[model samples]
Target: MAAGGPPPVLGVDACRGGWVGVLLALGRPSVALFAPRAAELVARAGAAAAALTVVGIDIPVGLSAGGPRQADLLAARELGARRSSVFRTPSRAALEAPTHAEANARSRAAGGEGVSAQAYALRTKVLEVDAWLRDRTAGPRVVEVHPELSYAVLTGAPARHPKRTWAGSEERRAALRAAGIELAGDLGEAGERAGPDDVLDAAVAAWSAARVATGAARSLPDPPEELEDGVLAAIWA
Candidate 1:
């Protein structure tokens, strides 16, 4: 998997509300969104995983005590992540605890902005899910993506979207329509931008997937190490 060229890139925009996966091949990204079901994500990730190397998922891929806790955080710091982010704090106390899952379920059940933080944390579980994906699957290496820093890579500069939000289905369809791409779903209205925001995020996440897939994305890790708990070598400095 580590031999030929860089591995395919996989990007996951995970949240408590739901999660999205972007798989990019050649130079295009394929998009999928769901409620972050473990079994389903692994299955959905199959296409790009076959030839993957570097993955840029929009989730915090490590634990932290004060700062960014994951490998991506080191990347983010290099990329200039402004202001500290609670980001993907654990929803549960123990890694094996049900608190995180329960929090996720509760957030999903509430709807609205209720699950904002939990959504971020949901990526942790998704990361675990990614691990399971690799163990059973036979292609591509996967890595976590920090959404903000990822945008920096995508645009060649870091930019924050304070008011910007992920676009919903109809919104994405609208943008695709404007761009002359076929809409995958029916959008009941056009004035709504939130829907579009979610879609745009998914697209960006897809871009991350594509970059890692095609060797366009660079990894800071000199001698890349297999990810594990409490390993400083896991991150590039």
Candidate 2:
């Protein structure tokens, strides 16, 4: 770490190809990389990984078996109109189901609502993080973060446009700039593969990760409920 500077932090977001990660150190984007797997991305952080103080990822972490997680409920309430951006996580049983139909059925049986195809689609990634955390490789530093919430906190309101839209992209970038993190020039191969929204989401996630590392971030459901296995069922932003 630089003299009197904040420890390194990482922000990661899932993309079409794999995952896009942005490493922030000394209050700036030090490097960006795209990895086919989450662990690979952390490894690519190299020396930064050793002292990585926190990692904020745009994915569900701790899961619930009986119903929707309180973190998800609180995050939705916080987003207001943008609440749709926050997908209610399916029960752990649903996530482990064999097929989408079965998953939906399991979710409805547990939570009183069927799982959406969109939310169900995240099962693989959600399970991946769950396993990774269980192994304790990146467990201690990893925290679930919703990019929309990070942006909402940054701009004092939920974003006014959809993330995939041009206007929305600009809105997110502007928020990052206002927070003193600039995304300019060439982003190398990773930036080329990941969508504009993915990159921006990673950047803001990194901003939140930095906040988390420095003890400046807040968690939804403030106290953060813990799963039976000790994983936190909360979203920090």
Candidate 3:
């Protein structure tokens, strides 16, 4: 930890085998960890509870029962052409589907627009984090974030390339470096455990987490709303 710096913050992103966490303490470079479930990630944060002040994850935090969340709608508008990056989170019923087909059906039944294949693929991850949030007694320590939106906030404009591409990763890395965030060590390790883009996303998420801890972050849907389970439904960047 740096002298007189704030407490640590955690930023996470779902990856190939599970979730990738980037822990940022006292404004220094971050440390990365991998977990197969949100529970494992939460446990890691809990273990160092005194050091951890905020958690920013690249996943939806709260869910709607049968419609689109206002936060999702606001995020889409902010992203413009990249609006597609913000998928409409399906209702809780849709998130429990056993298959993509069933997920879409359940989404429609729940009065949502229906699920996308990309969104459907995230159902398990969603449920994992959702379950943890529902059981959380600490009043919203973990908040939702989107890598694209975070990048946009950092660069002062929308990201120009898709994160899956080399150009995109380089662009985001450059932005982070410019912001004084030294992505030290082999970020490739993060890619190896998760995917090529995972490390950068996790790093940016940590940056956002730090912002949240310092009260410099912003949220979609301003005041935020509550999920059926009472979790706040908002996205931060």
User: Which candidate has the top score in lDDT?
Assistant: 2
Separately for all candidates shown, the number of backbone clashes (residues 3 or more apart, or on different chains) is 23, 0, 0
What are the per-residue Cα lDDT tens digits for candidate 3 across 1-237? 355555788779999888887777774555777788866875675574445778889988888888899888998999998899999988888888888889888888877787898888898889888888767676337888988899999899989998889899889889888766666666545546877588788878888887888788899988887767676788888
| Residue-level error in angstroms, candidate 3, position 207 | 1.2
TM-score of each: 0.54, 0.93, 0.91
Best by TM-score: 2
Model 2 misplaced stretches (Cα beyond 4 Å): 1-5, 27-29, 48-50, 137-140
Tens-place lDDT digits, model 1, residues 28-61: 3343445345345545656435645544445444
Clashing pairs in 3: none
lDDT of 2 by residue, 1-237 (tens): 244556888899999868998888774455778888887787777455567778899999888877778899999999999999999888888989989999988877875478888888888988987877777644338888999999998889999999999999988988887777777668897879898899899989988898898898999888999876577778999
Q: Assess each prediction's global lDDT (C-alpha) against the native.
A: 0.44, 0.84, 0.80
Worst 10 residues of 2 by lDDT: 131-140
**Ordering by TM-score:** 2, 3, 1
Off by over 4 Å in 1: 1-10, 25-39, 45-55, 60-73, 79-94, 97-137, 163-198, 220-237
